[model samples]
Target: MKNSDSGARAGALEVREEQDPLLHRLMPSPDPAARFFWMSGADGRLRIEQCDACEYLVHPPSGHCPRCGGDRCTPRPVSGRGTIHSYTVNYQQWFVGQPPYIIVIIDLDEQAGLRLTSNLLDCAPDDVFVGMRVSVRFLARHGVWYPVFVPSQAMESDSA
Candidate 1:
């Protein structure tokens, strides 16, 4: 509501692999409607679309509001705090040289039933739990910001 998304850069994570060719090929390009969600990483914030009519928040950025059929959806910044609704430790090598990682469905604190699928970082795969507290972190590559999550305990320590 306050446009607070841009000013706070503390604890911001930058991956710095802008030249990684593999990432360039792996990450999908954001179209015009979803640009805010992907590009907000430039300022270290996470934004999702909110409906102007019914105030319903939606992800994947549909041009029209899914609930109200309103065309006035706008991107709004979120707190980026959530709980791990579910998760999996992927042991198979989806790509060569890639280590096992935990993928999670985060239930964002913003609204009920609002979830985001993201990779869990900075924690051991075996240590993850279904209700772990996580906060959003950004992985910047080739001008696209990918949202990842880390244990909220680590985030608190980093800030101190």
Candidate 2:
């Protein structure tokens, strides 16, 4: 797939080895505060950090709460249902014969502003749209569970 606008800036993205070796090789840094969020997928669950004091959901787990500046936070399971806030189809061939893929920003249903950035799978680029309902699926690599989203209907049919 090629971008219609030739003036658009091309960006490099990290693709899984199981998918293809694209450009850079950067692994998730070992973060104690985010260990639960990363490893929770081992059991097929999506967990995010929540401020123990105010009960606000936090992503990219920070040890301290941004709301009340509370130092205590805990990992909580989420519904894993969300809507596409925005997305872009990457068409640059960082590697030869690399197919275009959709990267999306998802507005998680749990909270008003709670969101997550991840890849959209099992759907063609043309099929993706803003406000599309999606569900989470975890991809395990190097003991880290990376959450990827798919169309809600596709997920239901996958389980059927």
Candidate 3:
């Protein structure tokens, strides 16, 4: 199947092997605090750290709450909606396929300072801009799933 917006093929064959050798080497084993964040994607949910005491949301999964130094943080589902806080287009041949791709820092809607760094798929690298709305889509590789963002439906319609 072809993606209507990006013209890229989609569905079951979309997930490819890690084409960047350095990225493959740098993929870390999920620590206890981050295990849920990693595994929840396989279950089709975006989970982040939520502090039980202060109600602060944390990304990158921390053992203690950065706000109140509380140890009562747990994984909670987030809306998976965000805005592109920042991004860059890479022109180097780091991965397979083409030379240019977009990497974005998403500021998740759940809380301030809750952000994730992920690739933006289903759009041209040059099309990405700060403050662009996006939503998460999961891709599996090597038995692990990751949450990547794509242009939100609103953004798609605006472009159309």
Each prediction's whole-model lDDT (CA): 0.77, 0.74, 0.70
Could you give the candidate ranking by TM-score, starting with the highest? Answer: 1, 2, 3
Give TM per candidate.
Answer: 0.85, 0.83, 0.78
Error of 2 at 156 (Å): 0.6
lDDT for each residue of candidate 1 in 1-160, tens digit (9 for 90 to 100): 1122322542265444542223423666648898888888787778889999998999878878878899999898887889999998878776686667788999998899899998888789889999999987788866788888889887666565
- Which TM-score value belongs to model 2? 0.83
In angstroms, how far off is 123's CA in candidate 3?
Answer: 0.9
Q: After superposition, how far is residue 108 of candidate 1 from its true place, in Å?
A: 0.6
Q: Which lDDT value does model 3 have at 152?
A: 82
Backbone clash count, each prediction separately: 0, 0, 0
lDDT of 2 by residue, 11-105 (tens): 11122446532324255888888788877766566788999999988887997788899999889888778899999999987767778888999
Clash pairs (backbone) in predicted model 2: none
lDDT of 2: 0.74
lDDT of 3 by residue, 65-159 (tens): 88899998988877777899999987887556554778899999878778899888767877789999987766666556667777886334433
